[model samples]
Target: MATRPPSLPTQMKAQFLDAFNTSYALRSVLLPTLTSAHDILIKVDAASYCHTDAVLGAGKMPPNPPSFPHVGCHEFAGTVVSIPPNFSSPSSFKVGDRVGVPGRAFHPCGACFECSSPEGPDADPPGYSVYCPHSKNNGISTDGGFREYAVVDSRQVAPIPEGMSAVDTAVLMCAGVTIYAALKRCGLIPGQRVGIMGCGGGLGHLGVQFAVAMGFKVTGVDNADAPLKLARSVARGATIVDAREQEASEVAVQVGQEDGKKDRGDMGLDAVIILPESQRAFDYGVGLLRNHGKCIVVSFPEQGFHLSSRDLVFRDISVMGSLVGSNKTLREMLEFATKHNVRASVRTLPLSKLNELVVEYHKGEGGKLVIDMALPDEQS
Candidate 1:
């Protein structure tokens, strides 16, 4: 039933955050082992950096900050080295299967209203076990993918398609799924206009492609030249806007005129998906919506939103928040990504340069950065 590689080592190299506002310490730690019937042990091959890692490192995560000595990174892909002998799931995954874990919903409480459905978790529309408050987050609350080996909840892992690499799958685990789920929450049909507020950043660029693939007319809005260039390259037909060059109202008017709508009632986009962590981005995104349009908030800004009563009541604007996504959504996203050839632009560095990668992320690097665990330490 359960199998592992021959001569598996008892110890492995891992990066750990000793405390908030400190650097990640590289340490030799004991390899993680499967402890539950639903546990799957994976030998991690790649782990992608995320803004949440920076937030956690900087001690900005509110309410319950991650405990000390936590392993960073939530987006990772690897080969399954071991599975519980008594694995109790309708689906079957054996050792040696390539898989990716979405760290958002780990160990969801099956007794909750969101998890206890008559037709089961995989029912159409799926269960909202991702929203179960009692669930443990893989990277945030528990040891995660920064290590050579990780034990993930079997119920939350998805099999990687044959042609996809661990690096690409790692990016899709978080950034891809988050953006895809946010787009779905927009509730717009094909041919409708949608605005991606931070279209050039890690999630925004992917959002642009996914929106275009889904048959929506997209406006890629960002402040930097590089991201604008990236957005243009990815979605050729998208309307790329430089937020630094124009005010939110000005950009809104420009998008309206380009869409051939002169009337104020018909102007503006059907929905604006806010993907940046800037308050300005939030404000600007809200300004780009038409009457009765929706504003889907996916990024967490420290200051939060500053919405006026007019925008909510008079304009009939609906605001909603979306987290990473459920297992069903993850499968759909990966399938859609494969079919559409949607992928994240990523740069890879050896695991030894993880601290440097985090520093680069803080410097506002454009695209995703991944830690290639297989790389030799002397390579970089």
Candidate 2:
């Protein structure tokens, strides 16, 4: 017999938002009854901080953390603790079953509009549904995954592939799917060479793997020595370019080829995926691609940059932006992860440790931090 979910516990420890104007503080979770259909309860096992999380935690929001006093993560994986009323039966999952919910819900009604809309800016992110007026987002107005428990929409739940740990899967809920969806948007072909700029950071690492698994020849690009080594290790046989955008513009001129070759297999790059959150990186990605090649962009920066439409039109080079991927794409990502032993290198921390971790993260000291909500504070 399937095990029944434990009674909804009261007084959960949570990362609190004392005010709508401030960041999260460690506090207790309090709420009304969990028996309603609208009260879908989730025991957050793993919640990964996206770069967006950093900004929100800092209170840089048009409208702060959705509802104040809410958890602060969308890219998360957890077990179903309780289902609300309305349509609770035919349990999509039982208690203790491991599953991962993609970070966003684009669909509002039934089917997602992302599948129907022609791909463009006004179109919702690939995984969003028509109901998700606030598409391309999670934890925006809703309580996120930062707390020990969350009440995510049932429509948003998806399964994490069996045999993959929550730590590795957590990163996939957001970054992995974002890149996966981006590459899909580019419609890359087999044997095509793709360059992944910033190829070892939070999103870049996953991009490299996804490109590699999808049968593209991937070139991992980064400036740092440590991340470069990690990228090289994971993408064995793929080239590691020392070229950063700003650094590359100046330095590539200096590496004057011994054979007097300008292309030098670098400019011969077929496509480019810019994951770095900078305009320079976008420019460099465009430059690295072959004439007529595509540059798939995944990062968002404040300052807008420009490119010669003359260059784009004459060369037929395309610059396309990709947001988080669709639900189906996330499923594929997990299947690929399961098949190829793909895993996110995660440093597990306790939910209570978030205050410290967030500070460390901003200082550039952490790598893919995951909050293990179930870990006892004593063990942590």
**Best-performing candidate as measured by TM-score:** 1
In order, candidate lDDTs are: 0.84, 0.67
**Model 1 stretches with alpha carbons more than 4 Å out:** 1-6, 117-128
Which of the numbered candidates is closest to the native, going by highest lDDT?
Answer: 1
Candidate 1's error at 257, in angstroms? 3.2
Q: What are the runs in model 2 whose C-alpha is more than 4 Å off?
A: 1-6, 18-23, 31-39, 59-67, 85-91, 106-131, 134-137, 244-267, 378-380
lDDT string, candidate 2, 22-81, tens digits: 656887756323443433566778888877776665566544345566567778888877
For residue 239, what is the lDDT in candidate 1? 82
* TM-score of model 1 vs. true structure: 0.94
